[model samples]
Target: MKKPIILFVASIFLLFNKVYAQDKFTLEQCVSYALEHNLNIKQAKYTQAISEVNYSQSKLNLAPTVNANISQYNNFGRSVNQVTYAYSNNTTNNLNYGAGANWEIFGGLQRLNQLKQTKFTLMADQTYVEKIKQDVSLNVVNQFLLTMFGEEQVNNLTNQLKVSQEQLAIAKKKADVGTITEADYLQFKAQVANDETNLTSAQNQLEIASLELKQLLNLEPQQTFGIIRPSDAAMVEASKSAYEAVYVYNEALKINPSIKVAEYQSLASERAVSVAKGAFYPSLNLSANVGSYYSWNYYLPVDPANPNGPDYRPTFKDQYNTFLGKSINLSLNIPIFNGLQSRNSVKKAKISYENTKASEVLAKNQLNKTIAQSVADLKAAEKKYASAQISFESLKKAYEFSQKRFDVGLINSLDLNIAKTNYSKAESEALQAKYDMVFKSKVIDYYLGKPLTL
Candidate 1:
């Protein structure tokens, strides 16, 4: 049993290892995969599909209705014969079959208006699908940037660990030669350990970031993947003032999916009002039916000499010819009163239309505000990047000087560590500023109907 359990565990570990195999993808691949597989996007697609079906069905509703029916019955003594429409004390059998059609020739144009309303509602649903895709794309882009940032942070820590390891070796040599104090050598060793700890933490965070990205793509937790980092020159360097931002906002308004959804929904609601008003007018309809029927009575007798059936015992063909019928009708239904149903319906539809119109206004307003805020954030991030650049450069120079002094036993480990720490912090902050600027710019571009890229 123990052997079998061990084997099972080993196999499971191997399977997990296979699942964790590494792969790399570019930004476009990430966004595309998320768009195709994200649960939220898939759900939105389902809604769009349902709307498409409903639109087709609504168009079909404009056609006439047709139905076929057939029935049969048998009666005992004292039953009325269906063929004669008279009562008799004799067994009888009857059969009936027919096809009928009905069409609303006119219903205050409600059918046509309802079709238009369904069409507009379908358009709204289509726009909603596009909006969900855009949202997923934006989310993927943001998460991809964050993962890259975390990966770079881990690289920085790894480099710092290497430098700390080198310092520890130098401090050990100096202590052996009695040039550096034992306490100082021990401190350098401790700094190396701390660097290792920081590297491990940074790596864990990078892994978490990668996992979050995989979740967005609807991948399994054990799946392993990496993002292709764009080179510095390939990164976008978009610049826009408030005026340009406003122009972009106006351009976005022309095609934004969310705004389109609101507009279409409002139109659909207006059509609904028209449909409700139609209920107040008279409706016209046309109907037609054709059928054949038969009946028989076993109690009746047949005459051989006369070469003819007795009364009430007719031939099947003769009975069908006698019972067959065809008719057409035209009807008009003028509405009188219905407990104020039509009035209430029109009122409710009007209110719904007003609400949808307001929602459209809100959508446009929110879009404008978002664009303006994004522009402001981009400018702020630009300034931050410049300041961080200056700070990192100065700290780099100071740290280099500190490293030289510490190598020659002219400075304590504490002083050298302080300089190293400051330099690392500045590097991290600078990188953050750079990415923030890039992300903000991407958001503005996204709103401008530009393809999302690194």
Candidate 2:
């Protein structure tokens, strides 16, 4: 009864989880989900976790290590009693136990350097995790914009199909009344067919965009969810000129996780050199131990002939109280001639530090170039958008005039079709420019550490 009840409850919980996973995601929610689920981000988090563990263990390394040991022995011939260093010649049931601790008091500050280096590396790893998340967020933003654009294209094509179908009906009526040529009616029919085909294509594009968005979100293909576009108009009208490119780039330099990650890595490498140089100096360590042991074949310390004596074999308790031992030692290890491992390590660390410094330089240069290109492209797109808008408004008026003229038999089918085609081209070009400008502006926003949306 309990098993069945538990299974039913578990099934309900699983169903709830599945439903929640398919729930609609806002842009913020989507970004959060990707950070949680994206494989690259997950791996970066794991890497950061490993660095954290190393950093913590390095601190523990500064403290002493203690260990315990125990053993028993049987000997057919002469063998030394490990605990007392006495020779015995019979099978012996014995127990020996001890605990000892060793601590390195000084090692040219190597442990300190290691602790610092691991801490820096851990911070670098953490920053890299943020960098990976930002990358995934940007990708999600790109795909989100594409999906919305594709959906709008679908709506445009649907409207175009409706208008062409209505025009074809009017052309059919005119042809039946002998007011227009059969060929003209045929052109209207062809226009309707073309619009239908375009609508289908737009729908297909929308589906493809949605698929890409789902993939970026790390969602299963079968799961379904809706997206919200709360800032489409604002995005389209965003002006890069409002913010200076160099200022934005400089702001990115201050906050970008990739740069911080590189800087930390370079610092960690510098510490690595210190850790390696530590091996060139002498090390000092302190150690101590206290131990007591007993033999099973030995009796109480009350008899001499019977393996029981006050000064000989004794009970476990008597042995511990009377024969317990303790020792402490201080040792020093001086570096002599070994294979030049220390020198090579120091050399490798310096090289790594140099490489990290170079990577930081490269990252900064690339970011500057990318921002400059995006800014230039944005200005050009702004002009293009202005031109396309003007062209679209003019073409729209021309198409409206042609439609009225065709209805009153003042224009031929070719003239009407030409106006319609030009209008569609102008509208498409204008839309392309708008989205281009939107994307370019959003990039600057991304670099400036702003939220990505719409």
For residues 311-384, what per-residue lDDT tens digits would candidate 1 score against the true structure? 35667787678778999999999999999999999999999999999999999999999888888888888788
lDDT of 2 by residue, 1-454 (tens): 8999999999999899788866777778888888788888989999999998999999999999999998766666788765557887866677778999999999999999999999999999999998998899988877777777787777877888889898899888999999999999998888888888878987888888888888877888777767776675566655445666798789999999888998999899999999999999999999999887777655444554755436445657886776688999999999997799999999999999999999989989988888888778878888898899999999999999999998788999988988988897788788777777777777777888988765
- Per-candidate clashes come to 0, 1
Q: List clashing residue pairs in candidate 2.
A: 303-308
Off by over 4 Å in 2: 1-29, 32-39, 81-88, 231-233, 299-313
Question: Which is the leading candidate under lDDT?
Answer: 1
Candidate 1 wrong stretches, greater than 4 Å: 1-23, 74-79, 88-92, 173-178, 181-183, 236-243, 296-317
Q: Give per-model TM-scores.
A: 0.88, 0.88
| Model 1 per-residue lDDT at 384 | 89
Q: Each model's C-alpha lDDT? A: 0.86, 0.84
